[model samples]
Target: MAFTGRDKTWLRGPRAVGLLAAGAAVVLGLATGGTVTQAAPAKPKPTHTQIQLLSINDFHGNLAPNPATSSSGNVNGTPAGGAEYLATQLEMLRASAKAQGQETATVAAGDLIGASPLLSAAFHDEPTIEAMNEMGLDATSVGNHEFDEGWHELLRMQKGGCLNDGDGQNNQNSCPDPKNEFKGADFEYLSANVFYENTKKTLFRPYTVKKFKDGQKVAFIGMTLENTPNIVTKSGIAGLTFTDEVATANALVPELRKQGIESIVVLLHEGGFPSDPKAYNSCPGISGPVTEIAKNLDPAIDAVLTGHTHAAYNCSINDPANKPRLVTSASSFGKIVTEVRLSIDNATHDVDRLNTLANNKIVTQDVPKDPALTKLITKYQTLVAPIESKVIGHITTPTVVRTNDDSLESPLGNLIADAQLADTSAVTNGKTPVVAFMNPGGIRGDLASNGGAVTFGQAFTVQPFNNYLVSMDMTGTQIKALLEQQFSGLNGPEAPKFKVLQVAGITYTWNPAAAAGSKVVPGSIKIAGQPLVDSTTYRIVTNNFLSDGGDGFPAFTTATDKFFGGLDIDGFANYLTAHDPYTPVATDRISIGS
Candidate 1:
């Protein structure tokens, strides 16, 4: 139902920035007894003011359209995302609001860069910031990936510290490189909870107050995940700390209230739900972390816009009082945009009503591409084209590496395990890496060597997530305990499942017929042709994912004396490139014996 403003907040500003209205109320009518079947008169229209809040999240450096597919007589779908298309959509939305005398404001939740395709990553996220500026994004919360290049780089992206001087597109005079004439974005990056140790002040302003034409104030409080350091590279977040989201927001609420800002919106770099694999417009079966946060938030906050899960969901969750609090998340990869209309009580200066009008529209051919942005994209694409086209190696057949594929090790997993083992051995001072373990899930896609020669892009596809390599010390018993951790399963009908590990320099056989706790066959475990030595410790090499207990592997969390190498994929790529024109040397990384 369309929102009819009753007691709505109307703020006055130079321009009506973002005007959001509340949802409509249920009209009640009196009726006589005896099953009266008379049609009730329509309720009078509400006179409350309305406004539009336009938001996007988890864009993740998708400055161009992604490859899309449709089958079974599905409608024609174009590559969905592009800065030009997003700009067009925002402009059109703003125009519609202007016609209705409403205000519009655009914001993003975060994860603007990092783990991006080569196009954005190669330039250290400068391209993404440029695209975001062109698309007119006003502000965003810092995502974990924002720390991919570390806090200093994040600051540079925000303030154009790294761009060349005299870049015309941004603040013309402020560009770092005068000759190149590159521009920077004109937006604020907020971080309410992220802070430095000594000063204890937020890295950036905790929130920014956006004043509207009607003299109302809307405060956007932005923050990233509290466990950011755990997810991002440690060096990137040096001397920085992330506090709990709830604690941070709660602390800021009273301060915002003191400033006469009653309407509060949280732009957080986290989300809930997953989109249907068959359709980006809808999340078929997924509920993520955002719901939990929304449910527990203080009522002073009106709404929350979230991202990170890359799922789209438009649904209202109940508050503590059982009243509905509208919550929504649009899918990532620029697949869709979420528009929320909010209504605030004029007298109370609080959000009393809200209308959720989310349209996860497919960016199709019908929406003509913006020529200017397309040209910029082409320039960057050309720059990375050579790297993408370079032949890396060949895969004679499909090599699987999904964590939970099976008890048996996958060929790709074996290859990565060998690489890690060899690299770790080469690095140790005298003591060689006797064994190496690679997390299965870290190996994203398969190597279809039979199809054609593997290129850099193909290698990227094989191991997409930018996980780094780490070496840690573990006693022989600790290693066994780690292996045992993977064997343990959650106890329940719908318990969590575990993914198998791919190990090199070690061989172990497990019998499915054996009891759950005794699955490993006796005398079937060996490392470097020696019986497993419980008293001896070993130096192991693996990815950051395993070190962090991702994929339900808690054993890795116990690894000590950790060393963080650079990017894991870089290590793999360097290994492959050095051994050019490679072929798979299938070794029994794992063996299941009777």
Candidate 2:
């Protein structure tokens, strides 16, 4: 039977199905004409997609795990961290997210390398870069330490090439493997605020957009601390300008919005300190420069992942619109990973800020190590063994740590200050330095005596910056002004935050309760056991980083005469050799009074 168009429609309609079923109810008949009616179908559920962000900061090239007993080796009393273990943890985390139908991105705030252990640093951090690429880092911000070797070198790290400096330059062998030359980072390094002075162009891309298979997109804006110049070697960042973090970020919101990206995350290299440093997951009374920056950020920013203070905290800070936003930091050395979940509205293509959640997951050592990372680390360890294992000296104590006391002085700090002084004293020129000041921040790690024998590796870990020593002349009044500067304006907005200089061949009493500019007690300053004369010029020595006004000590820049010496690490190694079995120094040079 050939069916007409009307007959085809009737056959396909519910009338035909109802006739076949024999008891189905179908509505018929309207007032003016014959019609059929049926109920409407229900609507589908709204789509909400999940995005997982796995973040780490301040890794500092810790390819191998710290000894299980060391504080850095554990998180909340459980053994954690190492490239192998961290890789394994990240893989498992990604796998779990994949099973849950969530997309994943792994990112870092900053300091993935620089001031690294011998195994990584000896090859100019090539091994660390290789390992990171293997572990699949999506992106990272440029940290202050990234400028340790200058911006050009940082570019080399990004673009990939062999250093023009042949192997063995600066005691580092570049392109050690002829077969596998450095191929640079597979991940992008974003720097939103750092720009070349002449061109005013960002050193790298300002931000990056990651698109999912379903067409939703999120953007990441990365920047380091604005005060990077004050802490890093001035020469390294001479031609660049680092702008305000908040301003740079706010200005980009419109640009990102124009591109239809409503979800944004900032990977900032600055961080805050939690009241209880050991509470990895809770943010109790968190305060620092980062807090003010976070509070002032545009409400469009969904989350902020931070680092550089190396303190772990998970906080919900209120944005400019008085909306709570997720802010988090994982502890340094790959010990912890912050897992942040964002719920994206498919219809709006925007993050549902109210549904955001974050947590700090310890990279526990209980899991099996990633074979690939283990193989990479083993390759570098074998190459650095000769230099790393050679005994440099012996330490009497089990470990000369950098833990500061009430007076804000530490055993390692005192030891480094004395080493700089001793290294500079050999200058037969009549302008010998009378004192040496070491910024506490320069001492990166403790000198651990493994069975009482300290290897070159341990010493290198303590002072890995390889900064050169600089001796200069400063008047007694200027020195006092330097001391006053530590407790006041020069540091940062985080004032009243003290960075007391570790000193050698000098002593002074400071009034703890005194006013900001008067903390150094009058008539208490002394040099070489004699009262400091305001008119006398005293020769002082410090690392080039400080002499050029690093760590907020601008007073060092006002010195009269300057004499550059050997590398600070070499001097430290020489000092250890000269002392043989070194005893920990007493932190009694600086006295505190009521």
Alpha-carbon runs more than 4 Å astray in model 1: 1-46, 70-79, 163-178, 181-184, 274-286, 354-356, 398-404, 408-410, 424-426, 444-451, 464-468, 484-502, 508-525, 544-567, 578-594
Best by lDDT: 2
Query: Which lDDT tens digits does candidate 2 get at residues 418-491?
Result: 89998953354777888999988788888887888888888998999878899988999999989887787765
Off by over 4 Å in 2: 1-46, 164-166, 424-430, 490-497
lDDT of each: 0.62, 0.79
Task: lDDT for model 2, please.
Answer: 0.79
Best of the candidates, TM-score: 2
Error of 1 at 320 (Å): 2.3
lDDT of 1 by residue, 402-423 (tens): 3333475776777777777766
RMSD of each: 8.2, 14.7
Local error of candidate 1 at 280, Å? 6.7
Which run of 10 residues does model 1 get worst, by summed lDDT?
Answer: 19-28
**Estimated TM-score per prediction?**
0.79, 0.89
